[model samples]
Target chain A: MNVFLQELRSQRRSTLIWSLSLAAFGSLYLLLFGAIRNDISAFEDVLKNFPPVAQAALGFVIGTLKTVSGFYAFAFTYIVLCGAIQAANLGVGAIGREIGGSTADFLLTKPRARWSILAQKALAVLVLLVATNVVLLAVTIPVAAAQGPDFDAGLFVLLSATMFFVQVIFASLGLLYGVAAKKVKSVVAVSLPGVFAFYIVGLLGAVVGEDAIRYFTPFKYFDIGYILKNAAYETGFCLVAVAVVVVAVGASFAVFAKKDVQAL
Target chain B: MNVFWRELRANRKSLIWWCVGMVLMIYAGMAKYAAYATSGTSIADLMKQMPASLSAALGFAGLDVMKASGFYGMLYLYLLLMVAIHAALLGANILAKEERDHTSEFLMVKPASRSRIVTAKLAAAFVNVTVLNLVSLGLSFAVVEQYAAGENMTDEILLLMGAMFIVQLVFLFLGSAIAAVGKRPRSAASLATTVMLVTYVVSIVVDINKNLGFLRYLTPFKYFAAAPVLDRMGYEPVFVVLSALIIVASVVVTYLAYDRRDLKL
Candidate 1:
């Protein structure tokens, strides 16, 4: 319990920074929608000229370009990218700090079991990611509502909720990398490429119009267009996402428990 | 000189990984182009479907995707991103690792001046970026011949490579400057990554909306946009000079700050 609280307390500042930044980022996009709402038709016409591949790559849907909700969804793609990076950073850094800071020995010397420590760290990360989502929703929801009373409040909530799901996936992946890699010199080094590679894969899947490829990248787990139309996630992809998090996090705990801590 | 060699050796493995990663990415993207070219998917049909705003935002404004140069122009977006991240990571890691790994005191006591140490480290990083760029370019030339479409794309390819090199240098220096200016030397690579992401987002935002056109001057990604480079077969003199100025200013700042700042160790 002390380990959990300490880890949580230590992470508070960064969690706050990431949450505030994400809120500000989402708010900025929502604010931009106001400027664009009046000129949506003009914007749609402009968007209509885009190549299908390009549109797919950017997650832009012409059908949704005219509505504030549609525009928000478009902007939300990039926001999710940012949030994924934040979560990946947190996930990697959680275990990475112990290894990179050469404090794994110090941590291991405690009376608690390694599984307990891992659980506490994982809990800290989950709490922080949850808090981040709450702050993001707090800022985005009211601003989205202000756009117009007709804004689909339920759909907007559903769309925003995907960010948490995506974060969990990336966070688990990060934890795997943290435990699996021989040494992580920088958390950004590990997470940036991981996040971008998956993102690019998602973009390429869009360009290729390949449904199978979509299942491979977490960035495509929740399609805003599908969600807006069906008002729900693709059950298969959601299950795949949950499976990934569970397997990866489970493997990380197993590997980290037995892994030898290198003396600095 | 020993510092330079040490930096080079330390970065050797990652350099090879980056080179291999970039080569594979280019190969994969170009292979897709081959499919796009031979497939019945009409280039014009695809172009007509794309909106002007999206095309411009993606740096796809002027190129005809059917042509090799145009295709390369489109691929340049991904290449630029890969190279920028590589260069920035190299620059940040080279400078910040001493403090990060708690080896600052050992290095500080060496028979070398801080300025010389900084120069050697920066030089080593520059060399790594240069090697990665050259290898990728070589691999691209070899792969591009397989699907050249009979157009002379050599000049445009060279120009684009030059622009990428400049972009890499800009980010490299920017990363160094960030490391130099940071007080505690914590996660300089993360800082560099964030800066790159912000600039990239700004570049895309500016391209998507004409109202934000003024922001084009801020991001290094826009400094050598692919369309303009392909059309002109060269970069704009203003952006080129501006990039040079920024690089020079960043290097200068890195030197001054690194020389004066107290090492945490």
Candidate 2:
């Protein structure tokens, strides 16, 4: 418990940065909502002014804006992309840094077992990520509530929780890479583009009709659009993400325990 | 040349993935556009179909999906932004990789001068990016030509693709400069990613609200107008030239800076 607290404190700055960034994103969406909330009719009138050719260029039909579904379609796509990037970035250096600095040995050499060190680090980072999502939801709920729309708080919470799982999955995957790689440089170099490629695959899946491929991306499991509309969790997808995380983390510690740690 | 070849060799997988991913994304985008194309839906029809809320969300106004440029505009622009981000990080990390790996001392003790080494590394990074872009563009063109071709595909698309390449080049060099100047490899990568992401976010917002027009200038992306390029068959050569100047300055400054930098990793 003491060790966990110490590690948490050490991670506070990164946690704050991450939480604040997510908060800022939530604020941006609120601002988007506010724009329409101010004068819904006026906004519609402005849309009417654009030429048809100009209008088709935007992609979405304006009539859908009358419902929350409309907002989910357009805004959630960007939001999911942003959130995925955040998750990927948070994971990229989290495990790689510890392994890269050769501090895993020092940490493992302590009174605790090797598994404890890995578990504690993973939990700490996951907790930070989950905390950030909580802030995001806290900010979002009030703004959504203020808009005279009966918001589904449960759906929102579930969606936010899914974000935590998404982070865990990526973090575990990154940890696997960090543990396997011979150097930190190679880990980061390999992981950066890998994250973006996954994003592209997910985005393509979403745009096209590849529901199967969407399942491959962590983003698909905690889909913002689906949650917003259904006001419920997608249980099967969430389970898949969790199962993957558990497997990856278990594999990571197993590998880390045996691998030769070259301390700098 | 050894450094150049080594970088190319090391990055072969990345290069392949990026190119393939870009091609796949572009194909998906054009396929979406083709759906609209078949309906004989003028850009206006597509606009009318758009959810008012969605328009606000995507920040789309005066967008016509019918025009090839418009189709590419809605479809390909974001991909270009993604490519640029990838290119920037590729430039930064690849250049500083040896130093970050704690191999700089070993390499620096070799026969080559630091300047030559830096130059070769930069040249390798540039070639890698160029190949990635060319292949992405070529593959996209091939896919578009093969799978779907009904609308007027013009020189504008070629021009837009070219401008996008230039913007990508600028991002790469900017990343290289940050890598050279940054204190840590992670810091360098973070700075490059942040700059690219912020610029992209600002570019989206700036286009949404022209009152913040000045912010667009801050993003290297703002210089290329794919719509105008696709529609007019050419873009402002001056902007292309300006972007080139920035790329050259960034690469030159970063090379010089890295040469004199103490290997402190």
Candidate 3:
């Protein structure tokens, strides 16, 4: 409990900064949706004329620009990317930095079990991620509502909820990398590549129009367009997301338990 | 001299990885272009039916995707982004790792002056950035030729690569300057990445709303946008001057900051 509390307290500043930035970014983009809302035909024409490669270049996938959910979906893609980065940073720094800096001697020597310590750390990250999603919704909802009269409240909330799942997936993946590497010189080194690689893979998958390719990258796990149309997630990808989290977190625990901690 | 070689040797593996990634990116992108050319399907209609929410706005204006250079111009956006990222991370990592890994004491005790050391590190990073650029250029020319159906895209590719080079230099120095001046050496790489990504997002936002055109000056991504530059077939004079100023200013800052700072060691 102390470990959980300690970890949470330590992470408060960054967590606040990240969540606020995500909210602010989304709100700012959502506010601009008003300009596009006034001209549905013109905007639809612009989208029709725009090339897919150019859209992928700008990281601007997710369409239906004429509708509120449509525009929100466009902004939501980048939001998810940022959320992934935040989760990756937290996860890698939590485990990798502690062990790499040789501070694990102080941590692992405690009377508490290793699993307990890892659980507390993981729990803290999860709780903070939940807080990020809440802040994101709280700030963006009113802004989104102001722009479109037909704002689907339930749909908005459901879309916002997937951010938590994405964060969980990235955080778990980061934890896996945290323990798997022999020595982590920089957390950013591992986390940036890991997160961006998945993102690029998703972009490439979209370009090639490959459905099976989506299975390989977590960033593509949720089809925002499908969600907006069907009002639900694809069960197969959802299950895949769940399996990823379980296997990643499970392997982290197993490798971390018996692993040698090199003395500094 | 020794520091330069050592930096190169240390980064060799990662450099190889980056090179391989670039080669694969070019090959994959060109392969898709080839498929589209031969498949006889309309891409715009194809995009709409596959998933509307997958992509909407934020695109280059006035390029026929059917043309070979047009497709390469689109691919250039991602290439510029990837190369710029490599430059920034390399710049910061080279400078910060000394203090970060607690080797500042050893490095500082050398007979070489701080400015000389900074020069060496920056030079090593410059080499890394250039090598990546040339590797990208080579693959791009070959791949475009194979798929371009006899269209000569070499001149346009060369121009785009030149613009990309300036971006790489600007970001490399900006990153090194941040590391040189920042109190938290550990955060330098993340900070640089954040700055890079924010500018990229801002560039797209500008695309979404032309009212934000003024903000173009603030982002390097817009400085040499593939569509405009390819159409004009020349670098924008103002952006070229701006890039030069930034590169020079950042180099000055790197020297001054690293010289005066107290090593965390």
Scored by DockQ, the top model is: 2
- Predicted candidate 2 versus true structure: per-residue lDDT over B20-47, tens digit per residue: 8787788777766656566554545545
RMSD of each: 3.9, 4.0, 4.2
Please name the candidate that would achieve the greatest TM-score relative to the true structure. 3
Residue B193 lDDT, candidate 2, scale 0-100:
75
Model 3 lDDT tens row, A158-247 = 888888899999999998889888878888878877787787776575356679779888888888878888899999999999999999
Candidate 1 structure lDDT? 0.82
lDDT of 1 at A232: 90
Q: Write the per-residue lDDT of candidate 2 for residues A1-264, one digit (tens) a residue.
A: 554676678668856776676666555655565455444455556656666655554423444454444443455555556665655555555556766656656666789876776677777767767777777777777766665565555655565566566667777777777766776664435555767667767767635576787677776777565665577767888778878888887888888778877777
Could you give candidate 3's per-residue lDDT for residues B1-265 as a string of tens digits? 9999999999898888888878767777777777667644455444433321122253434455667888788778788888878888888889999988889999999999999999999999999999999999898888788878888888899999999999999899999999999998888888888788888888777766677789999999999988788888998899999999999999999999999988898
Q: List candidate 1 segments past 4 Å from native.
A: A31-60, A148-150, A203-212, B31-68, B144-148
Residue A231 miss distance in model 2 (angstroms): 1.0
DockQ of each: 0.25, 0.35, 0.26
* Per-prediction TM-score: 0.87, 0.86, 0.91
User: For candidate 1, lDDT tens digit of each residue in A74-189?
Assistant: 66887898899999998998888788878887888899998999999889999999999999898888988888767888888899899999999999999888987877778888
Docking level of model 3: acceptable
lDDT against true structure, model 3: 0.82
Q: What C-alpha RMSD does candidate 3 show over the true interface residues after superposing them?
A: 7.8
